[model samples]
Target chain A: MIDKINKISDVEWELKEGFMPNMSVPARIYISELLAQTLEEGAATQLANVATLPGILKYSLAMPDVHWGYGFPIGGVAGFDADTGIISPGGVGFDINCGVRLITTPVKASSNEMPKIKRLITELFHTVPTGVGTHAEKKLNEKELDDIMNEGAGWMVNNGYGNPHDLIRCEDNGCMKGADTAFVSKKAIARGIPQCGTLGSGNHFLEVQKTAEIMDEEAAAKFGVEKDNLCIMIHCGSRGLGHQVCTDHLKEIEAATKKYGINIPDNQLACAPIKSDEGKAYFGAMAACANYAWANRQMITHMVREVFCKIYGTEYDELKLVYDVCHNVAKFEEYEIDGRRKKVCVHRKGATRSFGPNSPDLPGDLVSVGQPVLIPGSMGTPSYLLKGTAAAMEKTFGSTCHGSGRVFSRTKAKEGMSGQEIKEDLEKRGIFVKATSNKVIAEEAPDAYKSSSEVVRVVHDAGISLKVARFEPLGVIKG
Target chain B: MSFEELDHTADYLFRCRGRSPEELFSESARAMFSIMFENNDANNVGNNGTDNGTDSGSNNCSNNGSNADSDAVRVKKEIEVESDSLSNLLIDFLSELLFVAEVDCLVLSGVKPKITGNSLKAEVFGEPFVPEKHGGGTEIKGISRSGVEIEEISEDDGIYYQAEIIFDV
Candidate 1:
């Protein structure tokens, strides 16, 4: 599979349409020669498989962090013609709208704050529910769950969990339209209610970081990030609710795939035409799961703020939300394709939108600047904050890599360092860690993933997104 | 009759084999539970102090003493899933088990599955998760149907069933 991919540029590779049978278009991958060494043949095959999906426009794309996932590669992106395209749950993933949100603090990082960092992480661990089978302090009733499914993060704001301004900072204004409670299942609701404010396990975390370097000072200023200042990054999703929704819908979509006779290389890619009843029902339910995820993050942000205020005498308003971007989701957006502006249903799995400057989807204050693309690193590694670039619009449908994709499996990562050993190593490096289990720490060791610095660089060089600032972890709380 | 781990880039992949389809399905459940929890064989640990006790430093089940109840309360849940194919039946059955584990907060073991054509019926047994004892391992977010192969192999000794399953963690 790797042999078939022809290098198009220093940061771009292409697998022509003929590389695989029935491929509607070529597969485009953004990766540097250095990063390409780690690329797996299975991931390349999956990208080719995505190209064979119906109504795929131009090319099936893979970001620098691409890896083999269920149906779509983890860092894969594909857009289908809205009128004739298909809607797939596998494309969106089980953890619908699993995303990242960054919050900037006015205070700067200092060596004296080590004790304070420890206290903050401890408080966060106790206040925010984490790990497997952990539930929130407050259980949502049926009516409340319905509202959350419809309103997204805005529901949290309405309930006094967050400020109204936070809504504007999120993609789609913290909510996706067409979300109906009628479409969501009781199993999903039951799974969601108890896990509303939770930070579920497996690669989900809340990190306290300090901006280490400012690459584009102007962009960094616009994003409310300053050199040496502390910030909080939250990574989570809709939890059990989203998982159940995808599980429930996949069965229906699988039946629909057979009914529609849509040929797919992988059963996980089972889909239905966008206009079909099964498709519409999935969109409604998916949007509701996306809303639930946004609400989950908003609630987490509120709790983080309370911890900050309790420790530093800071006000709730002091910590500002930089931006929130979904990593796993599908949304309708218009893009100029083949010189014709067309609406397409873009499915981004383990990827984020990199809408360039002047894109209408951005908030008013950010119109002059591009969208803030948050790229979180693996445990104990540096993360980058990048701004979307105009070149992304013409090439990759304004999408970019989400994070440092995994290079080692969970079992593989455990071979070297035990979670306790990794924790001690991080503490020695001035990065404090708190987690529900040592298993998570060991499994999420930095060695398990690719370098975030390298992943962001390939995209930046490819003009998908440009670096604004870099952050180093001061402390982390993992589920 | 046993399951072994396989390496994948981002998730958990394992292969299990048994003397029959029922054993194969049961072994798959055990394999999945083994991935989700660090100490799945809780009965081996003799102490009952695992019920959310003050032992915060370690998640090991105490094996020194065996109390009358062993502090671990066992519960049972039954599920029936029907599909057109045996593969779908396995996916549906495992998906149901995953849902019950998360929503009901049970770490299941001792699965007894009965299969008739494309339908599956199973009774699952486990204790409610005690974070103090059964250390939560990596969470298995979703069960993937990709590369799922259930096969029956004929050997001189007898016929055996085997399957390869991938999980999204």
Candidate 2:
């Protein structure tokens, strides 16, 4: 399989159609040689398999951080033609709208302010509930849950979580269009009500960081990022509610795959045509889940804000939302394909939306610049902040990498390391760490993941997204 | 130990051996809970009166000072997970447990499940978990389809049923 892939450039490769018998188009991957060194065999084959799906356009593309997943490889980006394409739950992933956001602060805490950094992280950890099976005591009734499903971040803002500025900074204004709770399952709704405003376990975290390096001065200035200033990065998703939504929809799509006479290589790739009832219903439910996730992050942001106020003696607006971006979602948008404008369903599973400068859907305040592309690193590493570029729109449907891909298995990590030891090691380096279990700390050890700097550099050098700034964690909290 | 840990780059998996179908199902549940409950003392220690965090200490981690025991409370819930195949049956069973844990903060202890008509019905016993008491561990999100299996394993003594499940965290 490795021999079958043809290198097109220093950072691009094409997998020919013969790589998969049913491929409608050849697959493409954008990765540097350093990253390609660690790309697993299954990840590349999965990328090729995705090209075999009906209605895949131009190519089945993956970013540098690609890794093997259930069906589609993580960091996958593919657009299906609206009139003839299909929607698959695997493409959107089980955790709908699992995403990340950044908050800039008037907090001028440098790397030297270890105590203050520790205090802020500790306060935020308590403010936002985390870990597996973790839920909030401030429960919302069914009515409020439904409202959040339908309203997204607006529900939080209306309920006084934040002002209107918070909504504008989020993708889709934190409210996905065409979202309706009617199609969302009752089970999904029940799970969502309690899980909202939580930081669920496994790779999800809230880190207190300071801007360590700025690569693009103009873009950094536009993004309100000042050198050595403190910032908060929250990485989580819609929680159990979104998980149920995907679980429920997968069954529907699986049956629809058989009824619609669609042939698939893997059951996980079960899908329905965009015009079919199953497809529309799944879209509605997925949009609602996306909306729910936006609201989830907004509520967490509100809690983190309170913690900030307490720690820095500042007000809510003093900690402004930089932007929120969803890495797992299917969006309905109009893109110019082959010189003709057409509607399409762009599935970004484990990939971030890199909306270019002046794109139609960008928030008005950000149109002149571009959407903020947040690429969070694994624990104890630097996360990158970048801007969407026109080159991305031309080559990869305005998509970019999401995070530092994994390397070591959880079992290997546990066998090789200990959470207490890792915690003490990080503390020795001036990083405060808090976690529910030492096991989690061990599993998420910085050694367990690929170097995030290597992953982010691939996209920045390829021009899919331009690097704006890089920040290193000062304190960390995780579930 | 009835179960052994398997390696996966992203998530963790457990392989279990049981003497029969009933044992296989029960052992699988036990193996999963083993991961969910990492602290044996926390599970066995009865109401230490140590004033640890309550069943819902998500917001009170700092106040608890250390990873102290939680305010434990007794509770019971009926759970049922159905599927066409025994492999899916095991996956569904674990998934249902995970769902309850997230929604109700329940830390399930025991299950005596009976299989009937492609479904398993069980009386799940546990307490509403407090991070302070339960010793917060890795939270599983869903069961993965990548490597789930159920089969018969033959030994020198006799034949036994076995199951393997990979959970996505």
Candidate 3:
């Protein structure tokens, strides 16, 4: 399968338009020669299939961490012409705005901070509900749920869960515009209401980390990273709400695909024209899910802050949100398509938007340094902090890899280690872990995923996103 | 007749087979719930190494057994759904069950699905998730339509249905 594609460069491969029939554009995959060896043929085909979508501009792109997903590859990124292109739930994924955020603290790590770290993680594990069927500490009513969908993280601030500064540090001010609650189904609301502040299971975790290394000293300082300083990272999404939204809209859009005569290569890629009624409704509902995710993360951050305050006897303000980036979800942004700037629907599935410095999309404080790209590794792996580069804008629609892509299946991982055994191994490595079950730990074993440093190296050398700092886990809480 | 886990890199994929579509659907549900509760046994209480407000290390709270305490709390729910095709009906049925599993905190079993034309009706049995009794199960995010397959293969002696499903976790 790899022989069917053309290697454009040391870090890039191209599958031309005719690789799959009806492909309107070519698929470009970014990976180092080393990482390319691990690339699945199915993922490469999925990328080519995405290129078949109508109104796809320039290229259908995949990052170094690309892996086979349902329809689009996990690290897929593509932009569609707003007036003539299409919107697809498969491209955004079921967990809308499933993303990550980094919280920096002035407290530096010490040689013997394990006891304190354990206490903090234990408290967070209890305080923040994890695992299946776990609800928030407080159940929200329909009215509050709507407010969260409409207002995003600001709803948390108004309810005293967060502050104004937290909002600005988030992408798109923690809320996507045009989120209409009317477009969101009641079933979706019911699923979301109880899970407003939860860290749901499967690949979602909260980790206490310390800066292990810093490469871009200036950029690291600007992002509030100090070598050896304690930082908390939270990875999760909109919980059940986002899942329901995707499920509900996919049915509608599937019908719309038939009505509009849109021929899709895969059922999951069923989509509607960007201007159609179904398309508009999906975007509105999807944005609402995205807001819920932002609100969910904000609440989790608040809980992390409370945990720190209790442990260190410090103020809540001591833990500051460095930045938050969405790995899934579609956004309407202007980019130079042909010669002039035009608005296109940019869909990022398991991919991070790596907006370069000086772009107006970034927050004012981040304008000089570029957006913070948090690439979380699997359990016990080293994660890197990277900054978006200008080359990303010129080539890959300002997007980059999300994390170390999985190489082994969960079954294979579990076959090698039990959750208890994995926990003991990490503990021996000086990383404390609190998880809902031993099964998830086994499935998420570090060996199950590709090397984080290798994936980062590919993107860094490809000039999509450059490495800024590296973090090693001190303690992790998973559900 | 039963379900088995299939290899998928990112999510849960399973292949289930039965003599008919109804059995295939039921087996599919069983497959999903089995994978979910793979690590969990009723005896594994207080599994998170933290005080989860539940009693720890008590064998009496096992929800899967004939214990009167757990049997008395068993909840039976009736599910009715319709779709455009059998394949879609399968997705809808499993998805509705998943919703119940998450929203109502039920570990469902005994999925007796009755399919007629592109519609399905079923009665399922489960009990409220008692952290002390059920411990932990994999939280499936949603059921995906990708790579979904439902086919009837004929043998020399009999005909059986086979289905493939992938769950986003």
Candidate 4:
């Protein structure tokens, strides 16, 4: 049951304390009435549960793309007191630090590039491993795994996987601290060892797109995304390693829940006080997973560049990383609460941080234009690259929606569509697609999700995150 | 019980129907776990004990006893899973059951599961007290409803449940 909701504006709704039992503060949702009504009852109910978490301050928030997830609803945002709040694996999701990275190419959008696009996608599918239990061609030994976990994308840059400039454009510079490899379990290490650079199945993809619209001139200039410019977007994460970490921590946190005398509505919400031993262990393990994901993306970026070099006979420098952002993560960031500046652990399960311009965290070159926000739409639809705004900081805790939220379940998606049929449809529309499995294609079909353009419209109008450019898909390679 | 094989895109579909969802969950668990090992002989490990050496089967049962319900005579669970492929669907369903046993302190028994393809139907009998007739070692968490759903195929109007579950890591 929920109550005390107040309409703050046309697009923003507030959930006051009396709305739920044990709630510590109010909650804010950035969405229009049309989008709100489409939300599943489970999403709102679970969001209420998130607000009850300990050490919560300001609000438990949901982006317009909010959908039901494990514990915290996907697209949900909540910040907890670093010293007193709890850390839950459910908040980070199974694919730790799963995110999107965009790279602009020298190529342009045109029907003439169809054959070349097909060749590039085929090369990518051959180079990148996909599906369940898929192992990479290059396996990591124990010491190498530890190094990759510690150094993150920096390790890749040092090892010739990517350039140093790529890291500068990534969120958190492509690494987070406190990832102690010692906290990771033997099973986790084993599962991750052979899967360092593989793209695991389900929703993960590598797509070639071309900018179709430029909405913000200033931000687009900073991001190097202009109309008709070709770009590559890689969507993946730590793979088996991240899944194992969540599995290992869920058991540990369940025990810690009893030890700490913490009460939660769902066992999936297992957690411990942030400063406690269990919490520290999970955080360390989670960081390692995050690093692994960054390294994986870096390796894939190298592959994408290789494909482009082979197709266009151009140098690697021709393709550059515009920005990479992690959507599923927990970060210790500084935010003002009660007029006091404090460190808070911000958990964004399926949400992205949309820090406004001039924030200290932005790269020096991007400081004047705000952080670049990458919102990948469903397969075959248009994806957006947005810029953060000052309004986002005041309204959505400097956060915005990640992508087109799921409207139909995977089962429903598969039932109504066939992968072959979907592939043919996209092909007819001049989009090339290479997938590891037909089932994955069906489950991620464009119709099974909300329109990304509509979702972006709500956020842009709401002033949470403003649109910079929209890219239409030209080709996609899915795992 | 009735069983049907429906197409689930890349994987074949298996659907089972019982009088109740409890029967569906139990039968589904058994059918799914059977894929992990070569045989369905539950008693083969009875005298052999756990080969993992982490804990004896009896000790595990004892540890689980404290968490059993005191007043309730029994609880029952039903499970289903949908995945893009057969292998992932199997792992997801079994892992989910393992999570429930380890975290929620629920002991599952009388599992009679049936798997047709990607669709798994199982019924599980859960009770607060450890069943004296059977020894315990494995547990199942509730299936994740995140992407779990039933879809109707227009080709034949066949209904299949697609779902996944997380187990104790």
Candidate 5:
């Protein structure tokens, strides 16, 4: 796979038309030499396979953190023409809008605060519902579920889970337009209802941290982040509901693929024209799931605040959302393709939007500094806070790397180490961890993933986003 | 029927083989269950660390034979699902199994599957996934169509069916 593609620039590699017979356009991957060394042949082949999709704009692009996913690479980003192009569920991963939200607190770090941080993480573990087959304290009826799918963070705020300003800090005001409850399957609804306000197992986590260093003082101030300031990061998405939606829609689109006579290399890459009934229906369901994810994260944020309040008697409002970004999602946006601007459907799986300065998607305070890009590192590592750059807007469809992509398989990671040992190691580093099970701790050990700083540097050096500050975990609550 | 782990850059990959197609599917389900819970069968009573080939950390919490506890090993569960083809039949079967694991906290065991027309009927014997009674490993989020392969291959044991599946762990 590495031999099939050639380096086009210092950070970009090209897979020409001849690389795949059915490819509709050339493919490009943005990675440094070290990343390319570990890039799997199957992953590169998957990226090339995405190029075969009809109406794919520019190049089927993969970010520095790219890895083999279902149909597209995990960090893959692609845009399709709105009128003639197709929409594929494979382009958007199963965890619809599995995203991250960063919140800043007035609390500061100190030697005496270590016990408090440990106590806070322990409290968070019990406060937030987690693990497989887990249910939230609140169960919703059909109407309430619909309200959540429709109103998203707005509903949460109005219902008293969050403040109104939290909406502006979210993408699309925390509710993507065009969500239709009717498009959501009954099974999806059944799965989603009980799983709301949860941080599902497998890599989802809530972390308490402090800014360790500042890379850009002005940019960090604009985002309300500085050294020694306490912060929280929540990583989760539309739990069972989104998984069911993807399963249902993937089957639907597979049938539609045959009906539409669109040939694809993989079954998971099933799709239909954007205007087609199947395509429109999938989009509607996906949007609802995305909204559900935002609401889920918001609820988790509310729970996090409750933990802080119980621990320190601080007001919930004292913790403010810096930004919430959807890593796996598809949105209709206007981008300049070639010389003319066109409206297209952009699909980002395991990737985050890094909209540059002056972009309307940013909040008022962040508009001048570019959108806040939150990148969570692996367990017991330093996560970076970055700002979107104009170069990102010009090159990556306003997208950047999401997280440190995994290097070791879950099974491999678990086989090599004991969860108890991992927890002990993390605690030794002054990072307390509370998890549903030790196996998760072992599976998510820092060594199981690539260096997040390296992945960030690839994108930052490539000029997609620039580092603003660094956050080191003080405590973590893992599901 | 037997299963073994295959190395993937990310997620869990399993290779299962059996004398026939039905056996293959059942073994596949067992492989998936073992990945979730070290004790795929109640009779084994959490035969922990050795089951995963490598140490699965199951000695941490094996089992006690008692019916009164919610953690008591379950007897059995019957499941039935249909799809257009065998590949989808496998996906549907595993998906329903995952649903039970996520929503019901059942650890599947004694999987028996039969193909009828385009659909599949399966019976799963499982126990409540008691953290106090069972060793918990990686939680599988979902099964994927990516890199899924079902083939008939011959070995010294005679003609057997084999499957390669990837899970979103």
Candidate 6:
């Protein structure tokens, strides 16, 4: 059922509407021929389904790392009319605002520091709560949670979890407005109360890496990444809070579908008109989840810095945040659709916003370059630090691929290998690994995902985004 | 029919041969829901309570024997689903069933799902159950379209139907 695609370029393909009924737009895939052939027929079929969604502007787009996912494909990018489109929980995914943040340190990656690197990772794993249902040692009262919902990472900085300057580099300054905590359910709030600083599980990790290469010297310098400098990247999201929020809103939107007479090809794509009560509620709740996620990662930054202090005997001033970017989020931003600037709610699931040079939203220091786009690779792979490009804004709605998207299923990875085997392999390669469960380790083996280098290559070569620096892993921690 | 664990997650899949697509979908839903509760007996409740807070109503059907009805009495209603891909179609189908179950407390009795190109058409049956009165079965947690599959291959027994699904704790 997947043989109908016609190649458009070395890294692009088109799944004609004849491949699926009711498809409003042709599905466009950005992938190598090898990866495209390996793709499950289901992925293409799903992309076609996404095309049928109401208010889907342009083509239903998929990145090179495209994979099958609920509602929209994991690497899918689509925009709906802010006034007429509908929002689906599956589009933003259960891991609301799941993203990556990079922090550069003066420490260099070296053999002499290998042991300390392992110790740092160990300390991080010990300090950060992980796995399913794992909660943090600290709890947030109702007032505090509300404040966090409103302030996001800024609240964490106010509480001394991170430096104030850190927000300058974070997307949306780590806080999205119109986050109504009242829209967030009590169950979600309860789940988030003690999970603000936890890492959670399933492809989430904290890695200590070194800047291995600089693709754009000027851009790299602006982002504060230097060759051989040690950097820390944390990947996580709102955890159970986000999941519950999606669940709560999915039902609400499902009901709204009936009320608004919105016909969705898939129930997972259940949505309400953007101006409806359901849409407003979901937008507010989703923003709240985004804030919760930012605050969650911000708290994790505190834990990472604390662990670093214990391992290097240095102070927090020694390590600095490069930037934080959320991949799974929907935002209302003004962009030119044809020739006119339209305010659209851009839903980027498994995609990151890449606003190019002179973007007013970017910090002044980075205005001449672009927003720092943190694209993390799979464990043991090279993660890239890219800068947004003008082409991104003009072509792909100011977005780029998120990471080395999963190629193989976790079961497939675990069936042929063991976590212990993966750990040993990484250790032999000079990369230290620590995790709460071996099962998780196996599931997240680098082999389970596409090479981030290749994903970055597509974006860079496509001129949608510009590469800055590459970070090679030295040590890692996974939940 | 084949069944495999979906990756390392708590999701599972069961592929079964059926005479029709709706039958395949029915078995798939049953197999997926079986993960949440013990489906071995019609009158046994191990530890999880049988009362699932919400009303089971007259339209609800449990997997147990008390709610069992003859195939003749099982009414088949046409079902159609639209999605971006086969995997999502399966997920949306299951999610729709879950939503119906939650709102109406009806357990789908049988499903004969047919995939004609990208559009899915199925015949689903809804029946009522008295779990507490029947002294069997537990409340369903939640349903998810996790590991889903649709294959055209037919076994000697019948047509093959399979997919993976998750149930909330």
* Model 4: per-residue Cα lDDT at residue A94: 78
> What shift in Å separates residue A121 of candidate 5 from its native position after superposition?
0.9
Better of 3 and 6 by DockQ: 3
Chain A only TM-scores, each candidate in turn: 0.99, 0.98, 0.99, 0.97, 0.98, 0.97
Q: What are the TM-scores, per candidate, against the unseen true structure? A: 0.96, 0.94, 0.95, 0.78, 0.94, 0.78
Q: Runs in model 3 with CA error above 4 Å?
A: B39-72
For model 5, residues A30-101, the per-residue Cα lDDT tens digits are 888888878888788888898889889888889888888888889999989999999999899889999999
Better by DockQ, candidate 6 or 1 = 1
Candidate ordering by lDDT (highest first): 1, 3, 5, 2, 4, 6
Please report the candidate that would top lDDT against the real structure. Answer: 1
- After best superposition, candidate 6 residue A394: deviation in angstroms? 1.3
DockQ of each: 0.41, 0.42, 0.39, 0.04, 0.30, 0.06
TM (B chain), model 6? 0.54
* Fnat, 2 decimals, each candidate: 0.48, 0.50, 0.46, 0.01, 0.29, 0.07
Question: Which residue runs of candidate 5 sit more than 4 Å off their true CA positions?
Answer: A1-4, B38-40, B44-75
Comparison by DockQ, 1 against 4, better one: 1
TM-score of chain B taken alone, candidate 4? 0.36
TM-score of chain B of 2: 0.80
Alpha carbon deviation, residue B141, candidate 3 (Å): 1.6
Query: Judged by TM-score, which candidate is best?
Result: 1
Q: Give the clash total for candidate 3.
A: 1
Q: What's the CA error at residue A247 for candidate 3, in Å? A: 0.6
Per-residue C-alpha lDDT of model 5 across residues B1-169, encoded as one tens digit per residue: 6889888776788998888778888888888887776455646553332323222111111223332143354557777998888777887788888776666666667788878976877777776555544544556767887556678897786898888898776
* Candidate 2 structure quality by residue, lDDT tens digits, A1-479: 44557898888888889787799998899888777877888888888888988888889999998887867888899899988999988898888999999999987775479888877877777678888666665678999998888999999999988989888888888999888788988778778877789988779999998899999898888888999888999999988888888877777787899999998887778899999999999999999899989999999999999888888898889888888999999988778889998888899999999989999778777788899999999999999899999888888888999999888788888887688889889999878988877778888999989899988888988889989999999899978
Model 2 stretches with alpha carbons more than 4 Å out = A1-4, B40-57, B60-74, B146-149, B153-156
Q: List the residue pairs that clash in candidate 1.
A: B1-B17, B1-B18
